[model samples]
Target: MTLWNRLLLGLILLSSCWLGLAVTPSPVATKPNVIIIMADDLDSRQLSCYGGKNLKTTHIDALANEGLKFNHIYASEAMCVPTRASLFTGLYPVRHGSFQNHKPVYDTLKSVGHYLADLGYRVGLTGKDHSTKPKTVFPFEIVTGFEPNCVAPTDDYQLNDVRKFITRTNQPYCLFVMSINPHTPWTVGDTTEFDADKLILPANWIDTPVTRRQFVKYLAEVRRLDEQVGEITRLLKETGQDKNTIVVFLGEQGAQFPGAKWNLWDVGQKSSMVVKWPGTVKARTETDALVQYEDITPTLVDIAGGKPIAGLDGKSFLPVLLGKSSTARPYAYGIHNNIPEGNPYPIRSIRDTRYKLILNLTPDEEYYNRFMMNAKQKDRNSVWFSWIDQAPNDPNAKRITDRVVKRPAIEFYDTQKDPWELTNLATDPTHQNRIRQYRQKLETWMKQQGDAGAALDIVYAKKKE
Candidate 1:
């Protein structure tokens, strides 16, 4: 063997080693980045992936198709401020002190921004900024991309800021892209795309001309929301963060229709969450395991490699993400207060996988929502009136409206059999044991959380927004 031939072979081996090192994924590139996109006043049932008969939600459906579909995720409280606060603090509504709309969280609590940032991640938020208040607590790097107001006349937006924020550095990030769509006035989307006549009304709603017209407007905003999801996911792919990032899509709460929002029915309480993590979560999978918004932060912390924050009511569901087990919690609880929205109508609820029990504190007094049932001439377009106007002759309409206004102190439902919660099984003798058990669990949870029962339903001095 010649000395030159041996030297040439050694040089070739060294160059090949350097080439392999260059192509290996960097540590920063492999670190998980989280992007959570949330929708406003959405009816999970309105999405085609969740079995909606309305217009197809192409982008959102794709997320469900490619990620884990959470069949039983819920917002601890159905309102905006409370739900987001619960999500940030990993605490229930009462504990977070944002139990009502426009209410603020306890000024002392730490948020996901603090938790993740301490662990060396940039945490930022864009659009629909509600719970990011008292900047000292939330501390999320404020970025502008989507609209902040839910009631704005227009939703024109630019993604330049969002694009810059996510791709700005190699450091891992947690960015929340909040979208205010299908919320109120329902004026932001292309209403022309939907035919009011052909839309399929939810079984719980009365089939009326006005109801159909109002629903078409709602679905249009839902379409706009779909576009927002599509764009955000596309941005991730464009930046080459598609494979390593953990992407989540959340439906904030139910629509604003009567008996939908500000009530304890499944539509208002139940939300949709679809998550995708390349190489971690299995694609085209689902879990009936119960999860709530309160559990989200702890899971994020777990993803950040941190221990559970002591004293938090929520526990991480990282195992569920890894497909380690099917169950996260045995019961998911609920609460509602109708003070700022209307009169003092307080409610509490508890449910497992199959059954739900609701306790209406003041069942005798009629339930009212200032936004939906107001007598002002301007509110004439609300679908609540359509249900009322047709209630006289339409037996179906009469049953539904009466059910909405008059509530029994105790209500129970087999949600698996009745998805919309149309039948109240409270009086059914067969389910007495389930009702008793759930009520006991409900009382125990309330006591632990310092929930003041109906006393929490009074008006508070308005805080600075």
Candidate 2:
């Protein structure tokens, strides 16, 4: 223990301490840029990335190749406002109480964007924010994330504006890019300079002359949307942020067709979901695991290491994204409540991997005939509405519309056999056992989630008085 020996030992201790400090992971390493590109009323079967033949989505296809694509992703509610609200709040439409299109989403609940903003991330939204009620008066500085230099109603140019925002932002950011291109008013020609003839019709859709013409217009809009996606991806690559940012592309709901958006069928609830997280998620992977729009908020929060609020219906699938084996929720719940000028007061559904059970709260006649007049009125302004109405004029339309509108009180479908869900097997004795099991499960879930519908009888009684 001489003076020289003591000095050497002290130096060794100091070096060890310094090495430990140098190797510690920084907070920045845990944070990643999050960008969600949400499409309005998009169907999974309509994208090239999802085996859609009618449309060419090169950019989105590239994203799917580079990341994981979900085969069975759904919106909590099959409508714009409610689905968006569920995505933001991680709650069901009944819980959030923003069940209708024009209904406002309350700001008191925490949103993924708000959480990121609180955690020192620059948050912005572009295109469409269909949250009926956005909590913050001025939640985002850049509305639709479009730059001042960009022209309006042009998908390509608007996406360029999004890229500009990403470059201009000084901090880590969460950008919600909402697209309205594939929505309604299917453009016949180049409303925004994209090819229309290259578009193909969906295999399931009828190939009649009228159907073909209608589908061509719809395909043109889908192409426009794909172009916008391409531009956004190009922007990310140009900025050198493609590898660092986690890009998620999803549809708010299904295609805006008859018995689609407002119904509880696969065509209404199922949507396209693609996620690209470089270095973490494996490329060219596809997952058939069931995921809901409500799960998006929790997953984002988990990735960002932000605090999750209590009573959220969604469970985060970060492990699934990171190429790890994990257990997701066993089932997803769906509600088809109010649609403008359309109704069947309240309908609830439960979908597992194989089967879907729908409970019609209103009788068939009351739900169909009562709403026919209102639907006809809505057709006055909406091309989709007008087209759907023309179904009665054509025998085929009559058949399709009849199956859609004359839904039974309780309907069951084997999702594996019937992805479009054109058939109802509720009355089939062979499937009676499966139907009962799902019905009971739905009731139990409703009770567990404190669903207002579970107490609908009481609520209606009080309302009558």
Q: Whose lDDT is greatest here? A: 1
Q: Write the per-residue lDDT of candidate 2 for residues 348-397, one digit (tens) a residue.
A: 89987788999887754444322223554664224334446577677665
Query: What would you estimate as the lDDT of candidate 2?
Result: 0.71
lDDT of each: 0.90, 0.71
lDDT per residue for candidate 1 within 1-465, as digits (tens), equals: 799999997888789898884434556534599999999899999899988988899999998888899999988788888989988899999998989887888888998998999888999999999889899879999999889998898888899999999999989999999899978878878899988888888888998888888898889999999999999999999999898889999998898988888888988999999999988899899999999999999999999998889889998999999999999999999999987999899999999889999999999899988888997853655688888889999999999999989999999999999988988999999999888989999999999999989999998887665
Candidate 1, residue 151: lDDT: 88
Residue 370 error for model 1, in Å?
A: 0.4
Best by TM-score: 1
TM-score of each: 0.94, 0.82
